[model samples]
Target chain A: MSTNDPYDFSARERDILRIVVGHIIPASAAYGLPGADDGAILADILRSAWREGRKLHEAAAEIDAASGGTFATIPTGEQATVLQRFREQHPGLARACEVVTARCYYRDDRVMRSIGMEVRPPFPLGFAVEPSELDLLEPVRQRGKIYRDAN
Target chain B: MVEVNEAVDVVIVGAGASAAAFAWSLAETGMRILCVEQGDWVKADSFPSVGRDWEERAATDFAISPNVRRRPEDYPVNDADSPIAVANFNGVGGGTMLYAAHFPRLHPSDFRVKTLDGVADDWPVDYATLEPFFALNDEKMGVSSLAGDPAYPPKPQVMPPIPMGRSGVTIGRAMNKLGWHWWPSDAAITTQTYAGRAPCINLGQCGSGCAQGAKASTDVTYWPEAMRERVEVRTHCRVSRVETDENNRATGVYYYDGDNIERFQPAEIVVMASNGVGTPRLLLNSASERFPNGLANSSGLVGKNLMLHPYAQVRGYFDEPMDGYRGPHICTWSMQFYETDPSRDFVRGYSYQFSRGHGPVTAAVNGMADGLIPWGEGHHEAFRSVFDHSAGMVSICEDLPEEINSVTLDPNLRDSNGIPAPKLTYRLSENTRRMLDHSVARGREILTAAGARHITSRSPLPYAGWHLMGTARMGTDPRRSVVNEWGRSHDVKNLFVIDGSVFVTSGGVNPTSTIQALALYFADQVKSRIYDLFD
Candidate 1:
């Protein structure tokens, strides 16, 4: 159960994860999004994924073995094929990776601003939503009391 | 050796919503009041909203379900057998700390479900009697709403309503088109500055514990004011059981302090303001030679008549982007579907509580779970599709009291203090199932009218047992009830329960407002008869 066990990721495992995550959320210039392999995001994802401990190490080994030890050096299309097969074979591993990666990705300040959100936290300066039309209640006002009284 | 503290005039258990109001009200009588709370005061700044991992924190740390949160102060409640889980907060403000602040009062008919709908037992007290207490609580707790709704008798309010945003406008327009009754919701969060607390800045973080001090958790609203009036509160102290004298009169409580050392705090009067589950657990654990079945359980109804308001959550996705997470997501609700209809399949109906769909993290998590958002390629696309464009309502269905759905101590499981954990054994009734189906269908209608492209719903929402009530109900019949009309234990004249545990029927609305009002009313009754309170 210790995260700092011998089952911690190897150097080869880290390289495989880098290539795998890049495919999970590849860079999108059109959406102005960074791939999950982006330096800081990848590190954050791996740090968070460290909690998965042996599960992560085992998944990385399985993913690497599926690509014939060339997952870190596979072509983009071949990598996708390998990942798809791995996902089908090991659904839990795919989910663990996706959860860690997406958690780090969405919370990134760059990603938040790209999606039209304020970079800062919710408090101190919260958003000011436009005031809705109070006149909308006019029709309901005309409808009149809808409650029942038993007493 | 168990430390014995000096005897106080009064000792209230659990400094949550009910205890806060009761302590504040009874403080006026100049009696020495001490409230023992298991959880410490929550630092709002330490809330999840202050960090980038706010969503993650909310889902895990500030989670509404105590089973999920599992903080040191929280005791586990085994809910594996129940469809709806137990949701509660153990801190100074209790459930208010993590509530959505959607404040709504129970209707007049809610008090007389048995007579009006021919289901459940009727409350010994009625809305007319508790009306003044509700009004006073509104002013004291800083209620914000428009008062002219025809839903009930005219209500007097002090503040204007919270902004509905585009989400509210769309929902309102849709309801108006359907000719259903809807109104701006009453929120406990402040719209304008009151009692020195800041106004809501629309953080949309009320559910994760409001950092802006806008949402009125009793920790901020009542405790501070009560302390100024000389009411004392001991935090991080869990009450093990209430003690009774040879005459069957209440004496005090046995509790574990911050260091987990057992101690006895004696009192002249004992008030049980613990939430529905905790109140019953304590009373039952207090069984003595005189009352072996359970203290104040002469009618054997102490842990009976449990009602966890069965909830139905329905979300509709719109094509156009709408205002999302502005603040106080529950800004308005519809009572059109409230009240019993003889034609419907259920005895009582439910109110539709509307809100913006999800925050960024929650959206991604839910989308991933639903298989709509993928890991590779078009992950961003699926997120954008449902992120801001989705809106929904939670049909707050009224749960009729049933003795079968109850909370009893597990034979094996225990808290860190070795106290038995309450095991919730609840099952959704057939009436609730039909009511949820109809509510879901009606919800789709409203969302479609508002131009939603698609709709999704989770009936009898699994993680939505937020409104715990009716385990120990109030009635005049001593053989079938636990407490009397004034919330005093019928068997033990000196004991009182002023929490949701005393509710007779689970109304189709959040019970925090009604719970506080009842606490105030019970305090008033106790004061009026102070000369012979034990009699």
Candidate 2:
């Protein structure tokens, strides 16, 4: 949140964003799945938004304004209501924020592991999927010669 | 301003899929072939698989549409008027650089759509004539397929088909339940190592340029062999216009080199392998005083009847994880609806390509956009539910060629070389809309049978103009078509166009394999009739 930080967000804006994204994708202790505000996800989101030229801070400010400038201080249920209104008013910004948060959060190792996915590049060590059973394709195969003949 | 003055036996414009095939076919003939490509050779190491940010790079740098990619080598296409945006690559491998390599053949019926369906014109040549070339191309490109496809003639030797992963198995089971014809895809990617290229590692990033050289892109499949046979491929050379003699025969081409220097390369025979859009753009740009309208516009059909297969996709999210990112992006497809039936509301039918959902980041963005994953409160739950639990199918529907859906020069927009940008005028026909609705309904049924919890469907993707065809159609009549059966220009005898531009009908399938086959067939024709090629 400092000037030297990669994101262009102020400390207050970052605090509001943390609260908003936490409400958006709250951590589930039962599933051990980390939320958008967990670990480096907020930093990752800020960096990704900065790289994509998305106005995350502006969206944060809009959410704060909608929540009467106390979005971070508000209760979780109240924050969700304010965020929903912000989403309704600014759909594009909502989509951008959602995309950035989801992209950064789901790609986090803990979230990926919690979802039973390997947190590595898909290549070099790809997952082993069972080969298809030819018997399952027999019905379509029996219908046979569906193409029109060439004259 | 340096002019490269040279003469070759055959000067081919564009070192794309067709050009690669043509050059490889003519390599044995010892013809002095020179192919000019606008983009540089995409090295294997440069593929996105080597990096962690492959998904983001694929969306930006290696995107199928030039409008989005904005690469320096790419030419600007003014597709503002068209519903389907023009998507292609300008490099040595062309669109193959980022294609899924789904190498489906045109059905025997595709050649005679007019004779069978009573719509669209019949191709000048039939499927039987091109079957041998198809076989040859398949062998050379290391096609991973299974024989006895029933959709094709008896092809004896197809490499083992790529394993259909979890998504394919689920989809195949669903298709069977729905009593639909689904087959392990005939892909250009290799299964076992063939022709010195490595076998596929199942990276699921075939659309982002294959780093492993597994996907038989021409750079790895054909260009290497062609270059070894002394086919001169001058990369980063963008051809501006075809120069013609007094008799309206193509003398050679004027092109701009890497340094933006003008050069003229003369040749005995000039072949334009620059796909459907680029071929017509070059022909129209080559207007001479003798043929004032355009190079081969005696019929004014050089840029008419443009056809882009109207495409649609449906994604199904299931209760169980499908392991959607584990295999080739496209390894299974259904052709049950490929043939037209009177019971259907539309005249033509469409084929369904089953995809093993996209990579993680792509799925995130697409899922979010389609509301499969919501924004607030439930975002984590929604994302988790759909992350690996999705299957998708894309419909490649037949688009009838209409004169109004054409490619013309934009009066204002030009490329880096100051050549007029090709403006595409296209709209989905009523037939196409009907076909899409029918296809999507069937797609939903297949997904439903597979126990999908929810489904998301797009009627037609606006950025799905992958198969550009029929801008310069082939026919016997000189007045109705720009090229003849063998891709020879009707007016310019020595000129040939061996690309999707000569497709009489945009078959309800991917067109790359057919484009290569036709190029091989045309190369054979030139070899047999070299003495009288000009006459």
Candidate 3:
């Protein structure tokens, strides 16, 4: 995390996002899916957050401002309420951040494998698809000669 | 620096689909052939599918839209006046480099639109005349499909069709439930390792230039064979304009080479296979003292009558995984609403091309656009609902030729090579709008029948103008068309256009198959008339 990004996305702001990520996509212990704020996933999110540059920083500022500047020091139990309110008020920005988060989240090999995706490029060794059921075309075949015979 | 390089018997411009086919066919006559291409060879291994961020690369580096991708070779198109943006690739394989390879032939009635429907002009050539070439192209390009569809006259598929995976069978059953017609779409993809290329291993994203060499882009299919026949394709040479003599003959072309130096290449005959937009752009740019308006533009219709088949997309999220992405974005399609009906709102109809859903990133992004996949607590569930659980179709609606829709030289914009850019002026006809609505409704019906819970649709899709055509039409009369029946330019006898630009009418199906068939047909005509080709 940059200590001096032009938009004030400093180390202090990074800590706030870590809290924000945990609340947004909390750990799904039942599914074994990590929270968005998990060390590795959060790193990817932060890198991608940098890609979305100022908007994310602005989102951070609004969340901080809305939380009476106590978003960082606030109890973990109360962060979700503040974040939820921020999301409801600024649905578009929150979603933009979520998309960026999800994009980075899904691209992780571990996350991809968890989703049953073969954590590799789809070339040289391609995926397997179920066999085609040409029998389904029986109905269409029965109704045959659908083209206009302009000839 | 601007001196003539060398003289060749025949010179072709743009090394795309038609150019490759035409060059291969004409090279049989023991004549020297040279092709000048604006871009270099795009190697199959360099395709994005070989990388982890393949989907992201597709959205950026290999984007189909030239204005968005803006690669070095791509020329900017001013499409501010048109609803649909121009999509093309500028490399050796041209648009085929990024094409989905859907490869469907135009229907027979598409030829005589005016005669059958009393709308649009009739093509001088009939489907029967080009059927043999179509079959021939299928063999050379290694098309794969099961041939028993009752949609049209019977034709044999070169190989077995790609498997109609989960999404296809799901949609097929839906169509069958409604007693609608659906069949495996004819794809220009090798399923049996034909012509030394490997068969597709179910590698999903064919758009990222099929690194497996399964997709039959001209670079893999025709260019190698054409090269073997000594048809030299000079890449990175952007032909600025065709030089015409005082006698109104196309003597040669002036081009910028790889070093960005200008040079003239002399030829006895010049053929233009530079697609709908590129061909018209070049023709209008080739305006000289003799032909003030444009060469081969005695009818003043060189860049007019632009026909971009308007496309409509509809998506349906299903309950189960639609299997892995297979075939050319689609393996099967419904022709339930193809061909015209006297009571219908439109004259020409559309093809229901059932499509497979996108990769993960694309699915997430599309879902977000629909506002179903929000960023909050339900993000993962919404993503899961869409990712592999969606099936869709696009209605390739036939757009009738209109003189008002045209491509003209942009007075302001120019390419890196300093050639003036092409400006597009187009509008969706009221007839087409009604047709789009009807098709979208049908798309909804089929998807809903297939047990789709959530559906989203858009008509006259803004970025689906991949099939550019009809700017320079073919007709018997010189005053009515830019090229004659055989694709010979009326004003300049030695000049010929063997691209989609010479399409008389935009057919409901994909035009690559027809484009290649026309190119081969034009080459055959040229070979037969080489002794007396020019007036």
Candidate 4:
């Protein structure tokens, strides 16, 4: 369901989530890495399972309450502080958010490219790896019949 | 609903690993063989690889545990009482559909556990007896590995080994530093094109049903050839129970068709290749007036002595990016600690398999579970640091047969067919716990020596019951075992059990190779003693 649904999330709750997830994975210009807010990852976060979506919205509301209804207006560092406090109070919810955020972010084309990987399914044309040198296994070959003999 | 009663020379239940091996072995005999499987043939194109959500699909459509997949063809299993959950696929290839295809032969010492270590009972047959079958199956399945592994006897032949990714190289260096015996893995995935199957493309999704047909799952390796040989495999036919005659001999089986219609298939010989748990559950459900306790369970040990390999894993984070997601999931392993040592508190031992880290989704989930990446700020940094920089290893430790840990019909739970669901009641013994702790500790040391910045070690995953064994053991003594050395039922002359359920002791390595070998060996026995089998 859309975040506009009253039972799911209000406009204020959506804004707060954007701020919270942004701090969780802030854009790193130095590393050229896209953060949680980039590539519509926040939208992906909002599209989680109903139970997890509710948890995320409730967690956002909790953050707003903790930040005195200014979670979105607060500075990024301050937002991180409030989110960390919420995490301490609700570790499970925090983990849920982290899992959703990481899962979505890594699948993003921009994120995958930044990490030097093709943004595609690993099939049809799977990646290649160089075969190992046989000499590398010389030690194991020298140690003969490691298994005990049957009596 | 349509019903049919047909008689065949041989009726094999469950078209899984053992069943495929047995059917292929007996195909040359020109006997009328019929295999009834509950699940449909899984097409290669339907594999997860073609989808963008391949990894996610693995947790859903291609999940190893039937309880999670909930496919129409799968039966539910009640595993709440057990610490080690049973994870098996129900399709034509069975568990091989989702197996990692790591095919390691059981150690010779694994056969004589009682004779050598005074623990579990010795296998009725020794490793030497099954070596040729192992070679045959390996050749047919296109096993890939280096030639000179000191851990094994001289094998017939093998394809070139798969690439050892950076993770494997790191683990190999650590093993060398420790002077431990490590070798390239013996895998069922083809390294070069063989038997029309393409070489592995290194998708790193071997557990998600290989789409390229590179993985040697029985659906591709045996079922096709067996079908060509005129062995009839009836899909979507779930065998409910093995029917017995008034003389207490197994005659055939009662099954539910795709339309949920009941039907009977009569046969001169009935083979149970439905795995450790499924085999026992079927036998227990087939209780009749002639064999009240269960079919071929005159010793009252049909569902007793369950053995699930107690597994544990350790992940090491290296400073450099290992590109740990680039190759086969399991490409290297070490048997340095495979042999039992008096110094160790445990009786049997374990083998260590080196793994490149999981795919992106699994890595993300695992990272959160390990608390390596916390929720708030710097989460991205933590995730990035661990993403491609980790190498891992799994220790498949041997679990002894204990009568207390068993598969029984759940009193309340039932499957789609209204048959009682199999309930697994299991707990780690003190001995197993000690062994797990030891393996984890050893794993940590290896990672530490390998220049790991950090390491995460834990007990076995609940879903690590991939190697199910020893539910209905085989032995010479009819008073103590359900089946004879030839896998024939001791009480019923024509009944046979050709699966891991006939294992006397759970070996430290994966049981698929041994399971196929034993099935082929028993099929040979059936051919040699055709006259004796009927009498």
Residue pairs with clashing backbones, model 3: none
Q: How far in Å is the alpha carbon of B384 misplaced in model 4?
A: 2.1
Candidate 2 wrongly placed segments (more than 4 Å): A1-28, A31-34, A37-39, A46-51, A54-86
Per-candidate RMSD vs. true structure?
2.6, 2.9, 3.4, 3.1
lDDT of each: 0.86, 0.85, 0.85, 0.85
What TM-score do all the candidates reach, one by one? 0.94, 0.93, 0.92, 0.93
Winner of 1 and 2 under DockQ: 1
Complex DockQ, candidate 2: 0.48
Ranking by TM-score: 1, 2, 4, 3
DockQ, all models: 0.60, 0.48, 0.46, 0.52
- Model 4 chain B: weakest 10-residue lDDT segment is B374-383
Off by over 4 Å in 1: A1-24, A49-98
Instruction: After superposing candidate 4 on the true structure, give the runs of residues whose Cα lies further than 4 Å from its correct spot.
Output: A1-39, A42-97
Off by over 4 Å in 3: A1-30, A34-102, B1-3, B324-327
- Model 4 DockQ reads 0.52
Rank all candidate structures by their DockQ, best first, as comma-separated numbers: 1, 4, 2, 3
lDDT of 1 by residue, A40-130 (tens): 9988877766445566777788888887778878788898899889889998888777666677887888899988888878878888876
B1-535: candidate 4 lDDT, tens digit per residue: 4365768999999999999999999999999999999999998888887766676677777888888788998889888988888899998999999999999999888899889989879888999999999999999888998887888877855798888878888889889899998888999999888999999998888998898899999999999999999999999999989988788778899899898899989998999999999999999999888888878889989988898998999999888988557778997998878888999888788899999877676776788778887654555678778888899899998898889989999899888989888999898988889888988999999999999998998797788888878888999999989999999999988899999999999888999999999999999999998776766
**Best candidate (score: TM-score):** 1
